[model samples]
Target: MGERLYLYGIFPAPGPQHLALTGLDNQPIDSHTIEEFTFLFSAAKQERYLASRRNLLGHERVLEAAMQAGFQTLLPLQFGLTTEAWEPVQQELLVPNRDRLKQLFAKLQGRREVSIKVMWEPDQELETLMRENEALRLERDRLQGKQLRMEEVIGIGQAIEQAMEARKLDIIQALRTALNPLAAEVIENEPMTSAMIYNAAYLISWDEEIAFGEQVEALDAQFEERLRIRYNSFTAPYNFSYLAQP
Candidate 1:
């Protein structure tokens, strides 16, 4: 590849634009229009940009600026997306894929992704389980002084694990039941750690952001003693995109 264009995202226009936003290495961002939508870019020489903090922030700044530019539909390309020239992208990708992309914009317009991360302390839950389950308490008493057998130990560990999973599911179900109706779409991403009970993304419209937040707060208050429900709404809705091409 020769000189490249580090792509940030696409915006459907007739709305305002602020492409003057700086990108990776403080490169001035640029754009190319194909009918109603425009692709945002900047000069690049590297084959691939490393996932450093500065570089990632620069990439995100451009997309977030687009969000602030007053466009209802902003299709944020994934970080590190690049192309050698805009011609092929215009002729091959943009022109050919216009109708499909338009439909995508319709689905994405007026919406933003909201993330919810629910976590709990594993040791605390295990203590609760021990106090509540008589059989588990008996098993603990029986093993207190005897030679610890591998099979007996594994059985107790499995039982505790299953109970923890059930509890996690029940809490998640309650959250979903309350919040899913307010969202246009919901994605349950895999938990990143053992402490995580629910890791989810919701596609919420601008109109429903407040109502959605109130629901989250109520749920958090209800579960505050046992679980911590954290939410983030600042980042772009890239997770819910079909145009976030790498």
Candidate 2:
């Protein structure tokens, strides 16, 4: 049996070009052109493409290299995507979806995905909330006198939780307000950590990349003491590409 093709992404056809890139197991990366689209892939054994950290990183590395090579408008395939051979990709993926692919290629041209994550210093925020909340102070005083009943303790905990949720929501909303105008599309992701107020990905045009960065820098300076804003602007359009998947 032949080795499966590990699909990385699809890019606009650049005629014939060399990608000085390697994929899983150090296999040389190659491309197949179908019409105006080029599919980036590498040959690999099924076992080598398992959902291991190494394989996942290999998939991202290939896409990253493609992006760095000036393929700004690209669609990244999900990790672990493989085919028995290249023929199926053409008959099933390319031929059937040619029109849609072309449309997406035009729509996504000169654009890239950017991710922004916002986090607040939990200790400082919590301290400030506790110090300012009158109800919380009363509750703390009630608990200080003697051994607290279960309901009393539960009430205090609930208050803190509610305050945290409200703060997180406000922070997320403010961030979206500051960033949405600069993006063609916005996708909100779940927070990966308790300290994370928001995690969002923005589809930004290459022409507006500088403007977007400047906006982020402004927000960072505005919230420097309380919230930390971190961003990455060169990633493949993974969030937007899923909508184009067959």
The worst-scoring run of ten residues by lDDT in candidate 1 lies at: 13-22
Per-candidate TM equals 0.89, 0.87
The TM-score obtained by model 2 is: 0.87
TM-score of 1: 0.89
lDDT of 2 by residue, 1-246 (tens): 567888888888862257989998788898888778788888866654568898888888888887777776787888888887777888888887887877777778878889998888888998878888888867777788788889887888898889977977777777788899989989999989988888899988888988999989988887778898889977878877764554
lDDT (Cα, tens digit) per residue for candidate 1, span 146-202: 777899888877877888788777888899999999998999999999898789999
**Model 2 misplaced regions, further than 4 Å:** 14-16, 45-48, 244-246
The total number of steric clashes, by the backbone 3 Å criterion, in model 2 comes to 0
Give candidate 1 misplaced runs (Cα > 4 Å): 1-3, 14-18, 148-150, 243-246
Model 1 RMSD to the real structure? 2.7
How does residue 80 of candidate 2 score in lDDT?
82
